[model samples]
Target: MLDHCNGHPLAIIALGGVLATKKSLDEWESVCKNIQSHLQGDEESYSGVYDVLAMSYYDLHYNLRPCFLHMGHFPEDSRIDVEKLYNLWIADGIVSSTQDQIGKERSLEDIADDYMNQLVQKGMIQVNRKVSDGRISSCSLHDLMRDYCLEMTREENFLQIMYIDEQQNASADALTDKARRVTMYVGKEDGQSVLKSLSGKFSSLRSLMFISTSTEQDEDEDSCEWIRTLCRRFKLLRVLDFEGRVVLKGTFPSEVGNLIYLRYLCLKGTRITELPSSIRKLKSLLLLDLRVSRVIIKLPNVLSEISLCWLYFPVRILSQEYDNTQGYEIEDGSQLILNKLSHLERVSEVDLDKVDVKSLLERTSMRNLSATCRQKKESLVPFLKSSTIKHLSLKIDAGLLTGNSEMLLSKSSSLRILHIDAGSWPVTQLTIRVDMFPCNLVELGFWYCKLSEDPMPVLEKLPNLRNLQLHICYGGVEMNCSDTSFPELTYLELDGLFFLNFRNVKMGGFPKLLEMAIYNCPLQKIPDALHPGINILCSSILDPLANEYRLRGKASEEVQIPNLNTASEEDQMPKLCEFPLLVLAIIPFVMLSFYFCRSKKH
Candidate 1:
């Protein structure tokens, strides 16, 4: 079957994907026979490869076909955020609702994740990046695959892409009005004009995306007009994405409330400082992303009227400054009161100092929380006692995790991933004990805690930890790991530990480790032995053992250790010398001699 592919990479990949699900030899034989039949007349042409790619698409189930086509809506070569894609799929009904055998309903996000995994297994989609816990964060399609998807979308009248520029020759007649989704790539300076041109054209549009292609600054006066136009015209919009594309001046346009049918609204990376009261009118909104936006002082209680499943805000937006003179009152205080939104499941970067953690948990159905404790004396015990929260990120003073409060984390049986950052505060000594961590944690990280002792002895006992990161969290000179420790650990990262020792790492330690990274750390050797396929990354400088391993030629396939001497070696090579002065002096004489020779010839 591969021989018929003419050694084409895409064909081989597509063919492998097509055959991956076939269980019986008869089915594989039938597929190969069909491919041969397609290539009978034109074996040298790429039509056979196209057939293989098409077969992979056609193999998708009815529910997954639309989800696959939706990938075409993103800009070419851009990494599509998987979380955003899931929301879009849910909003568009591409990820259909399902129920288990016991008649319990399943969430749309779960179904979208399943569909994405199926496509990934079939090689129709490529994973671009993953989070530390082994879940995909972003993904992309190959250029050839993206082209195929675009062609299918055009044929199905699913979506249209417009590159908004002066030279664009697309006429109203040429642009299909049936395409329910439209993506516009335009310069920041031409944002308003482009929006004006696209108005009322695709009245049936269900999704609209504005992607900025230029770095030019935007004129805010004209910016809100386009948004108002969008709300008034595209009344049926389900997904409105302006991520990093526009700055909504000082406030969100009240006109957006007109899109009552909107489900996913992304304002990420924008400069909007405030949300209008009218946003409460979006009763159908499911996801609102304000990550990396300018500070928003207050969140209106009216937002509880909407059914939001995922809400992300900038870290400092919800944090407030206490006015000691005013007693318990804060200056421009922001209260996170989303208790009425029963469907809300995830919220990030909430200020625990102002918001009661226990009250927030009991009032809402949120299971994923990211909060910050800015007050130096704030208790972290409330956060550690919760057994419902699955993913937690806490940025607090280092001293807050001491004694009984630190031991409370082990009570969080439901926690899967945890990150603690105490970089802002000064602490003389901090100790980490094995009993202080939840046994079920799959990923854990510590930053700037300046621990007085080595944590490896405690961390290795975690039965389920797969990813571990220590960024200047230890102050000791030496550390040791017992043999056969870290049975489930796969990735380990050490950063900013300039004088730490690695000589004590046992050969059998980190038995299941697949990758290790050393950054800004001067180490002479790694563990004596490791798995054959393990990957080692040394960012700053490679020590003697690493250099020797690299020289052995076995490191070429699995290791990413940078060769620091390459630049210096190239610099040391001999160079050509120039006699510019002598050449300049002879130039005039040579010119005069040439003139005399010409006269003699005349």
Candidate 2:
């Protein structure tokens, strides 16, 4: 059956999809002959793929067309955020919530999510990133799928994307009355000219996105001028995304309030330290994304101007970032954050210092809450007591997290999803008892903690946990599992366990564990046993073994095999030359072995 069709994967898959319905041999051969004859003339890979993709595209539910096509507006291979994308789809009037007489309802967001899953299953898109709770946070299209999107978008007059990298700038000849939305992906400095010349050129333009092509060294000297120029020309824009750029000299331009029709404003990567008061004028705005950008720092204290006093000061501040290689001090911003940010909604995503957690609890009723707890607020019992908050993402401070501070998460009857991120804190080695965590947590993400102690004992007590991730716990000793651990955990991931000892785990420890991953960890091999149901995905197991070989002076040593080779073990250089590699690899293992030996002795 496979011999009749060309070896093209898409062609084979498409033929298989068609052939699955055929019950009789005659029906199968007749359909097979038709496919084989069709392949006789058009042998190009694109043709085969086009037919397969087209067939699958038409097979989609009618309501999914616009949502699927809308994704083409994003830059090729772009990491499209699911929340942002679905919100855009909703705002674009592409999909809406629906309920039948049977009382089953599907929200607009849910519909978009289902469409995304459909596309993913059909191999139209790939998951690029997942959030702490294992939801598809971001996804990207394949090169072929992206190309198809471009072709379909142009043909349908949906969205016109202009690239600054291409010669002659694709927008020069492409702008027309039909182009309702324009996305300028900046890759070169000449993007200024492209925008300057193209202002007011498209009367139908309702959405304009200026995405930075590169995050490195993007110094937009005339970004203010660009904003001024854009506002002057495009007055009808519903979505103005000047995000991921250093906007208006570290200040949000006050004129942003003038865009009364604007619905979404994303300023995630901007250098803006203070939001101008005029922002409150955005009455039509539904989402105001102001997430701080994540930058790697050699010295965490360098951003002390902002991060310091994380406990009490108003988060909003008028300040410059750490400019010099040697860091600089910041002016005290005690009054800057409190007085400036006056428009705090009841249930909003804001800086920890922006609004008091108490103030938020009093003002409104909310189902989801995200709050930051500085070292000062380590006693999380107050926030956990809030009965309204079911989904909570709490940011933790890393400085010596051991005090009288205890997080009895199980006691929080409301909290189902608890995301704990110890941002930029070094956990050289910290012991956390099982009593400190919430027992009823359905999802727990202990990321960036650099824990040095075994977490299995601490986590396995959570009977209701479905998804658990222990990421970047660098100085960990071992991941030991007892017999009655993880009774209901479905997904378990242990990442960045750089110095793991890879010790004890019973075969039936995680009886209900559906998926398990141990990545970027120094584990030579899986434990000798595992539950029959657990999919223990321990990739990069070779890295530790490679280190082990380097330890025995066998990494690059010439072996004494009785075969035709250049040199034998004794014929090589002296032991002194191998000293560095020996210490680099073997000394640690020796210490680990000694520790185990001593442990057994004890």
Candidate 3:
């Protein structure tokens, strides 16, 4: 059966999936015979591959059929954000909240995740990257499978995609009115021209996206104008995404308020200064992302009218031209408006200096928070002790931990991921002990803490930790890891500890480690126990050392070894005698030749 696949990955995977449930060899033989009967066409044509994929598609559960078809809405070879995709699925009404076997209701996001996992099991989707807690962060589709999806979508009128280039003439007439979702791929230089050509009304469109090929181009002031025109045309849009693609500078379009049915709005990495006053009319808005925007928007009081579940704003001023006040709302007046949103769940990054943490935490349902504190007296104690927060990232001044604030996180049982960065003021004292962390943490990171103690001893005791990163955080010369330490650790990184020693790691340490990265740390040797089946990244100076360890283990990993064969050959050759001996020998010969030449001349 495998031999008949012609080494086509999709066909092989689909056949494997089809045969996975056959318990006995006879059953497998029967299935193989049936598959061979269907694969009786020309191998050069992909008809056999398509037939296999079609079987997989038809085998999908009725609920997953639409979810699989939705993959056609994205451009080719794109890594789709898992959260964004899930949210879009929910907004499109294909995935809905459901009750579990135990009668507990599961959120639509959870259901979508399970759907994605099932697709992955069926081998239709590929996982691209995973988060620290073992959840898929992003995913991509195989080229052949994507082609199949596009074919299916066209037959079903599920989506329409326009690729606008300099040579292609894209006009309103080019699009079909049946496509409910439209994704336009255009280069930054020609974005305006493409927008003008797409002036035709899309009455049936519910989702729209603009993906720019060039991201570093300067902001075109007219980009927002076209969006305003688009808003007037597509009043029924549910999802409007410009995530990290096109840059919308100047004011956000007021016409966007006309999208009353909008559920998801993304302006991430844009140059927009503020949300339009008319945006308060989007009562159905669920997620509003403004992360890394040019200026920290002065959220209007009318923002409280919407029920947002995910709201992400900039933590710092991304543009150098903007002043401190422009990037952060130091005034506490408008900041208090966050407390009134009853449905707000996820937010990044609120400035600690301006927000009243107690009120914000007490009034809202935020579970993921990214906050920064530049002030001298602000405390992280409230955030660390919150049992509700599952993921927390804090960039704060070291002085905030002057008192008993260091032990606050021990009470945070629900916190899964924590990162504390004190890189701004390294001169101050920032103490982090093992007892100060929660036992349930799945990922932890420290930056520029400059601790005098070896953090490995304490961090290893974190039984659930899966990922750990330390960048200029340790100041010690030697660090130790006991046997069986970090039993569950999968990823480890060490950077900027210039004088650390690595010989102290015990034989059984890091038993589950899969990846390790060492940067700018000049270690004489790596521990012998850490040499097998681990992906290692290091500076060029340490490449030879790592490869030597791999060779000692007879590992087949490839590494570059610098060549010095010619230099060694040159050193092995004979050399001339000392200057005095050579001069004497040359003088005697010269004297004989000179005497003979003189006699002949005479």
| C-alpha positional error of residue 547 in candidate 1 after TM-score superposition, expressed in Å | 13
Report the lDDT tens digits of candidate 2 across residue range 1-602.
45443476644564565555568999876664554333222546466565555544555566666677778767766788887676566556565557757986544445666778766766666787664445688998777667666766776787877666545354433567668777777654543665654655778677877666765665554345456566656667777765645432344566776777766666555444445556656665544555433321111111212211011111221112221211112233321232222222222333454333454454233445555454445346665787655556555555425655555454666665655555431223455677766665677777555454567877888777778887764454667888887887787877765667665887667777666676656565555555444445543322453333344555533222211112334433326765676466555445534444454465
lDDT of 3 by residue, 328-405 (tens): 452336444566677566677677766666666874356677776656344466677776666676655555556566
Cα lDDT listed for each candidate: 0.68, 0.55, 0.68
Q: Tell me how far the alpha carbon of residue 111 in candidate 1 is from the true structure, in angstroms, after superposition.
A: 1.7
Candidate 1 residue 342 C-alpha distance from true site, Å: 1.8
CA-RMSD of model 3: 13.9
Cα displacement (angstroms), candidate 2, residue 304, comes to 29
Count of clashing residue pairs in every prediction: 0, 3, 0
For model 2, state the Cα shift of residue 73 in Å.
Answer: 2.3
Cα RMSD for candidate 2?
9.3
- Report the error of model 1 at residue 217, Å: 9.3
Worst 10 residues of 2 by lDDT: 304-313
TM-score of 3: 0.79
